[model samples]
Target: MALAKLKEAIGKEGFFLELDLADLKSVKQAAEEFLVTWEKLGEFTSYTCQWCHDSPLDQFTVQGYDLQFGTNTLGRYYFTMLLLPALQRTTGTNMTGKKARVINGSSIGHIDAPIEIPWNVLKAGSEDSKLKG
Candidate 1:
């Protein structure tokens, strides 16, 4: 398994989750798995925010959200909420002796954000060309 191979190579505890943020189920499952596996976390989940230019049929998340927004925004948000308890447990235990910090790093995603709200793309089940959701 990928996790086994990663452990073999680095000898550190990690898990490989088939996480699909658009599918809230996957997000919840990933959180549950993490809670079972680890207790403390300095959380930094980097969700790559982008508006996909789907050249084919438009794609939407399993929960009928724009794939990009659902995964990049909602998915990570939900994941963090699920892990809040663990993060709280580790608060003030870190080397800095301060409370835990949750960092969501948005890397240059704003530049690519649509100039205007493409309502067709934003709404669930709305149709558009090449844009997912």
Candidate 2:
């Protein structure tokens, strides 16, 4: 299976955790589980790719935010904040002798978005407003 291959490729130390960023509850739960499972977190990386244009109109997060903004931005923020304590624990103890980092990957398409994003529209789940912005 693909997962088996991934594990093999990454070696015995690499691990994967299931997370659904679209759901705030899931993000909170995953962060809690990660803290319990891993005493020290060296790096927290999130690679959510929800193209703003490709997002569906009908889909919305439980908090009523636009799916793309909720999943790609808010969810990641919440999850990272939740795991901050664990990350802080690794401050000077990293085996690599480097500071811990949180990386969130964004696409080049983000450059095309309006410089001033309409936060109200996004929070209100207005897909049309998002497109216009």
Candidate 3:
């Protein structure tokens, strides 16, 4: 719907991109497509996200990461790191006269009650853990 609205406003000048940041495969695909197009155009870009995904309010996982934390912070961090090379190349001031900007659109939720990481839970590990083997 957001994509549709943006397309309606921008018409042929707009392209739609869908990325499910919860999944690494999707992130890789987005990074590859972005690099190919941006490098071709010799244009620079910035990225932003308002971390909004959430789990049911009452539940907690043993591994200890909240759904919003995974979606907002971890996913944003991974995507930025993955695309840094392309972003840097395109936005380098020597070429485009612009430095790449990364806007992590955070909210009062994170600011007001930041998670006190349970390093123990983080280390305990779970099969569903998105981090890695």
Worst 10 residues of 2 by lDDT: 124-133
Per-model TM-score on C-alpha atoms: 0.71, 0.81, 0.60
Clashing pairs in 1: none
lDDT tens readout by residue for model 2, 1-133:
7778877887655566778888898889898889999988888778877876555655668887878888889999999999999889998898777878898887887877779976766765454644531
Worst 10 residues of 1 by lDDT: 50-59
- What candidate 3 gets wrong by more than 4 Å, as runs, is 1-12, 40-66, 92-96, 120-133
The local distance difference test score of model 3 is: 0.55
Q: What residue runs in model 2 are displaced by over 4 Å at the alpha carbon?
A: 54-58, 125-133
Q: Which candidate gets the maximum TM-score versus the true structure?
A: 2
Per-residue error for 105 in candidate 1, Å, reads 2.3
Full-model lDDT for every candidate: 0.74, 0.79, 0.55
Residue 51 CA displacement from its true place in model 2, Å: 1.2
- Candidate 3 TM-score, true structure as reference: 0.60
Q: In candidate 2, how many clashes are counted?
A: 0
Q: Identify the candidate with maximal lDDT.
A: 2
